[model samples]
Target: MALSFDGYKLTEIINPNGHCTQIGFTNENEPDVKKRGVILFDRQIRYIEVEEHQKFKRVKVYTTKDAEPMDFDFLEDNYANFDLFLRSIYNQ
Candidate 1:
């Protein structure tokens, strides 16, 4: 499923390996700007860390309008593939 957030679409990535899914958002007007993360079943959000070379820095992931601005940590041991996905995209 997909939802609109901060002028971008937060879409769920289907993973064959697990039940958890990763959500990603990219700037359509500026492809270089993007973020990939996950939303817990209870609605908590966490984004993967962008390297220093990436165009955008760490930022909040608002799942909905009027949602509270929240600080998130980089994806670590969990969802290793998803973490790689974020790195690959930012590298591009």
Candidate 2:
């Protein structure tokens, strides 16, 4: 499966510091949030990436619309790889 945000395909993860929040909002009446980009991973692997620089567990996943306002803080808190993250999510 593939996920795209604001015309930007979920290709690589962004720096989780002050960069993830760089995504701005639209000028619509309600000011909708616009995403800067997206982080690509497998539904079964749940690895987060920023150019193969790092890998981590998904820990938690949520619909972008209902997720915390531009919060990717979890990206900085977890790092389970080698199929571990994926395995944890499925309990398989």
Candidate 3:
């Protein structure tokens, strides 16, 4: 599937378990220009370029009450669990 961002074309890589990996940018295409990171979306736009070519960041959550940042937990393969995890993150 085509995922476009700011007129840039993104290639989507789907895992066997149905998770998606959208490659948003590459420094090589810009001829060795130092790139900060890449944009990607799974269930949502959970990232805005990677940090230091390593860390994956989720979209920030804003709520009406005190919410503590929770540790990233890897749930075993299940779409329901995936939805739950994503929902919980946003609810925080």
Compare the candidates by TM-score and give the number of the best one. 1
Better of 2 and 3 by lDDT: 2
lDDT of 2 by residue, 26-74 (tens): 3233345443444322333323332223532222334334332222222
Spell out the clash pairs found in candidate 3.
38-49, 38-50
* Residue 29, candidate 3: alpha-carbon lDDT: 51
lDDT of 1: 0.42
Q: Give per-residue CA lDDT, model 1, range 15-74, as digits (tens).
A: 433334345655577676666554433233334333332333333443333355533323
Give the C-alpha lDDT of model 3.
0.31
lDDT against the true structure, each candidate: 0.42, 0.31, 0.31
Please tell me which predicted candidate would have the highest lDDT against the true structure. 1
**Root-mean-square deviation of candidate 2:** 12.9
TM per candidate comes to 0.28, 0.20, 0.20
Please give the lDDT score at residue 45 for candidate 2: 32
